[model samples]
Target: MTGWTTANILSTLFGAALFPFMIAVAWGKMVEVFGAAGGWVAGFWIVGVSWLLNHGLGLHHQAGDVWIDMAMAAFVGLFVQSTLAGGKPGKAVPALISGVLGGLLGGLILSIMA
Candidate 1:
């Protein structure tokens, strides 16, 4: 097992930090058209499908820990956003923050135990 470290965790977190924002920007229209809940539904599906395409298909290795971290972040973010948004959800910003934080935490653990 590898050891977890603060540096690696930070690396992962920072690396993924801007990803959610980009995703939000690109998909913002779809989300707005669908409404918050609908946006989440579509967003989650997109995330899942994209993960499968990228990870399952081995399209890229640079995003190695993305799936797990994003999943964790998305779920947690969804909950937090829904709560904070007062029924309406803001997917991109929250998801990005959540995903980055979650990814960093996951990377820390993985690096430590890997």
Candidate 2:
């Protein structure tokens, strides 16, 4: 058995498509649990959990590609939200963390839907 199976492929696509919402949902949970600091790593947490799920399910992703995409999702999701809210690129950890919280929230929502 391997991730190349059609089932795995479809599941991957499904997960990928709903990632935005997942971030949202996850972020809210993270904030509630870890407070503002949780945001710093919430995005990474989602990517880590999601990747683990994929691998556990036997999905095959090529060399770092999955990680790269996941990281991008985490950063971009948060970045956009923060930019809109503050109209600037935050340099401090709090700023980054807050942004990630937003992404986490999105991820959580996606997970619920899925």
Candidate 3:
């Protein structure tokens, strides 16, 4: 909270929102695959994918130690994934809202930790 730079703020928002945003995108698929346990499975899949991307795509987002990846609220879209997959333009509101919230809250949490 003392040294909150624009980079930190932006990074937290991006990192935290990344998981939920992805969840929203993949939620429908997860549900389709695991039936009742898709949410949990998706969460794990998210981390695994992030790790792979971090290595494959070089997503190095660990500034010192306060790296943000809050998947708890991923269900916020519940996510944009379904909307995207469903091809419903209007339903994208929830997905967008969730992403915004995810970014804000994630930034706040990271700021506090920092």
Give the top-scoring candidate (TM-score). Answer: 3
User: Which residue window of length 10 is worst by lDDT in model 3?
Assistant: 68-77
Per-residue lDDT over 1-114 for candidate 3, one digit per residue giving the tens place of the 0 to 100 score: 666677656655565567666765686678888886997887677767865654345443445565433443354444455555666767567977897898899789978996
Candidate 3 stretches with Cα past 4 Å from truth are 1-30, 56-86
lDDT of 2 at 62: 36
lDDT of each: 0.55, 0.63, 0.62
TM per prediction: 0.36, 0.39, 0.40
- Tell me the tens digit of each residue's lDDT in model 2 across 11-75: 65565544555676787789889988787688677666766665545343434343435445445
- Cα error, candidate 2, residue 45 (Å): 3.6
Question: What RMSD does model 2 have?
Answer: 11.9
